[model samples]
Target chain A: MNAKDVPHQGSFRSSLYLFIILMIIWLVLTNSLKTEELLSGLIISLLLTHFLSANYRELGLPRLRLKRAANFIAYVFVLLSEIIKANFDVAYRVLHPKMPIRPGIIIIKTSLKQDIAKVILANSITLTPGTFTLDIKDDALLIHWINVKSEEEGEAAKRISERFEKYLKVVFE
Target chain B: MKKGVSIILLLILLWGVVAALSEMPFGKAKLEVAGHYTDYGKEDTGAANIVTSVVLGYRGFDTLGEVTVLFLACIGLAVVLSTLKKQGCGARQTPSLILNTGFRFLFPLILLFGTYVFMHGHLSPGGGFQGGAVIASGFVLMYLSVPKIKRLNHFVSTLFESVGGLIFLVIGLIGLKLGSQYFLNNFLPNGEFNTLLSAGIIPVIYIAIGFKVGSELSKIIDVLLEESE
Candidate 1:
């Protein structure tokens, strides 16, 4: 998703994208289809989208494609499964009297270029049972591990980020 | 020793304040007005949300005063904090990549939510003050996330704060001229029951107050951030 490829300046497309997102949020929140609510929402969202005239310059809305959307959906499912599995791991550890744990902070590098993708990846890591995202330095993430399986950066990145990164790379890159 | 003395002072002050406030007949002094507002507030103010009616309908002048107080506090903070900074602000560690990148996407959504909250103040649980605080929180989020984020244009922030106040004042003046000879009267037709355009000037005043408070709070955050840096 190269932002530069998209015509960003004074583009109605950006406004339209923002409008759709805001309208969805508005409808979901208000849960009303009355003409008054719709009309007011339309006016309000439209006016707010006018701020796009300023610097939402790098609005990183993903390019919509069937394959990419499918990838994103897959990514969400993968994330949910990972979180649930991690939750059970946590539960198992907590229920056990003698806690089986090795905790350490490991720095893992990512191939991902976009900050948004990196953030999502970090969030996914944090949500999972053992690994907590402590910080991000450029493309590298400092993750605190409940069990330090691999001291090596490459192995750790593979163990932690690789599963999510493949789907994200295809979707985001 | 100093901490103990301060605690004693705080306790004495709290006791004195609580003793004075205990005799005020809490929440019962305005029964007739409260009854009138509760029973007929909907029809009278055309706001289904009774709190909205009481706030923007009956106590609008007070809301104006509150917003002014906030604006003054922002100005006071800026002046006081700017002097506290030693020379140019010192450099700090840049925020993580996740935060720096995350803010751009989240900033607009938060702003929209705040707008929604304030815009729907008439029909919803939230009002201008809450929504404005929410909007200001969005800026605070951005500040924490983006270390390289440029300073807010003081000119623009001040303009918005003043314009919002002016709108609130002008609407009151308009109310006085056209409707009842009272300040901040609901002069305009309250469109329909429980609709967006209903509540007469409540939504208008609330939106202005939202802008005023949001800008003022954002400015305060900017000043505080600068001082810390």
Candidate 2:
């Protein structure tokens, strides 16, 4: 659904929040406190925030609380370590004389209600060694796995997405 | 027979590359103009990046012509794509939760990055063209992932594109009126070197260029996406 169709509240406050954030980014990027720079930045930031916050409020954009934000950061760290482990696994498999790979596309279901969380789950799965997300149809993800460890879809989905989905749900949902 | 022809063509390309490489030795200074630009570019243009001075200062008219060519290309793309039978919006499938969420999260970050790139064009490797392309890519990602959202507003994009072009032209005209009777001449005070506010008219022109290019490209993408909808 288009954001314009949705009803929302406190748009002005949200716009102010966006303006302040954008101004800080502008300050950092420009690395200047000159009158002209500040003036232009204020004007541009206000315009952008006004336009953007309207859509944001309409969309019912998720509020990123401090606790969730911190959890998201921690989640990133965990994903990175998992990626590194996957890389090592791929390398070991490639270096082995006997290429032991049973590549197959498996259909796996995700319970993630938010689009962002589902995307994160897919990306994390793809980043992790030996699994690549090929497509997303409804609640199911089509994944290409280097080795099909299980024939059961439930078992495969659990093994692949369960680790990341828990944190994603908390961060996004 | 086809294989032999392909091999012969490859060898010819290889020979040409080798010959060109031999003419210009690796890891050696060449091009007398390069030395001149590096030595006096800062003093003359007051821009820290000699490359920016060269592109937007030394041969600004040429850059303007290039921008016109790009504008024409976008116009041509629109003309060509308009004739195609447009797809109904209903044909599009809803994107997965993951793609939709990821796109929303990254869209603002990409816009911020693009702005940073164009703003620092005078001081860094990036410029209007690169930044504009980045912004367009962000739009493309949005179009791909979130098909249900309303398309990019055509009126706003076209307005920004025209406004940017107008600003560039006005600046050039002002340069002719105030500075050396040349178009795009530095009219305002070239502020202190290596500063954000430095390089009179260069940053302004680049910002104009960034907006123009960003809008034009995003418009082209919007058309293409809609045509396939």
Candidate 3:
């Protein structure tokens, strides 16, 4: 069953997560470590968590491990590098005299089974300058390419999503 | 035991609020504003609004930390929510022409209003947080009405958010070291009071916050809406 269909059974773990998150936010927004702020923040967060815990079932908290954390960090670096490279590539295209470019919509397939992984894959694709994810249907992503290098689905997928998908698979799954 | 803790906490909170409220001059004939303002001498920070003075001038260090916290909150939310990132799984909604047209026109206007708000922050009630929220709302409208602008570039969003925050921090550090020993006070000349150009560090600081908060909130909104697809 999908996450949304899950019953409103708020677990201790989810409640704790929500409470901690709220307390942290309260501290930050108040910008105070005073007893007053702490007491108020504690009470407010507890109250909010009590009320909102039912919906926590839909939040779908992930299980974390060291290796996965490291992989996720690595994925961030790779994404940053790609984004920077894409920026320059885009600048070059815009500044070029001829403005030579071919744009087209192409369908690309993904190996990611998890829904979260696929969404990140699509967003990462969008963040990289040359592509935009138009839609995601099943394991397929409809991407609008600024410069369509290949019409073939596999080639497009390799060029656009392969890099991010590699780390996302390990980190999320 | 739980009830006891809850009662104690509520009492403490009530005491705090009551203490603050007791100081207010609700129905005084000769208000402190009438007498003290004349002594306060030309809007100490040259800001017309006392709230602006407090927000971006007097307690700017707090504001800086607040903006940083807001940014971090966005990042945290994104990370947690991204774990559950299921988008385009559900059916899509097609936006009507009126909604599309409204987004096209209203988005820009909202942005303009936000800019105006933060710019006039020193003189008026609105400031960085309000302006930034206004700008983020524009992006929310864009997502809802215009289907073509699929997702905000997270790279761009982070860049703007960080750079904006960095400027605020750098300015504060410089003020702390070089200028008067106040948190974010600087030696810059305070321009004429009740004018757009007034409030030396305030307008600049608020504009930075506007950018930081606007982009940060937009990123948060984007992450949540990513699932809506």
Docking class of 3: incorrect
lDDT of 3 by residue, B109-219 (tens): 466557657766877789888989999998888788656544778788889898999889888877878757765875577887776677788888888889888998888
lDDT of 3 at A25: 59
Candidate 2: give the clashing pairs: A115-B97, A116-B101, A118-B98, A119-B98
Q: lDDT per residue, candidate 3, A4-80, as tens digits? A: 44344547766776677666655665565757447756775676567556444344444667988899999999999
Model 2 C-alpha lDDT per residue in residues B127-204, reported as the tens digit of each score: 888888888888888888877668788888888888888888899899899858989888878898887788888899
Provide the overall lDDT of each model, using Cα atoms, as 2-decimal numbers: 0.83, 0.79, 0.75
Alpha-carbon shift of residue B86 in model 1 (angstroms):
5.3
CAPRI-style grade of the A/B interface in model 1 = medium
Best-to-worst TM-score order = 1, 2, 3
Estimate, for each residue in B13-61, the C-alpha lDDT of model 1 and write its tens digit: 9999999998878766567778899899898898888998888887777
Badly placed stretches (over 4 Å) of model 1 are: A1-16, A53-61, B1-33, B82-86
Write down the RMSD of all candidates, one decimal each: 3.8, 4.0, 21.7
Of models 1 and 3, which has the larger lDDT? Answer: 1
Q: Highest TM-score: give the candidate number.
A: 1
Question: Candidate 2 residues A1-173, lDDT tens each?
Answer: 33344456667655665677788888887787888778877877776675566534543445758878887998899899889988988888898999888899999988876444566778999889999998777678999999898969989978888878778778866
Worst 10 residues of 3 chain B by lDDT: B96-105
- Please give the RMSD of candidate 1 to the true structure: 3.8
DockQ of each: 0.55, 0.33, 0.01
Quote the positional error of residue B156 for candidate 1 in Å.
1.3
lDDT of candidate 1 over A53-130, digit per residue (tens)? 233456554666788889999999999999999899988987889998889999999998765688899999998988
- Estimate how well candidate 1 is docked, as a DockQ score: 0.55
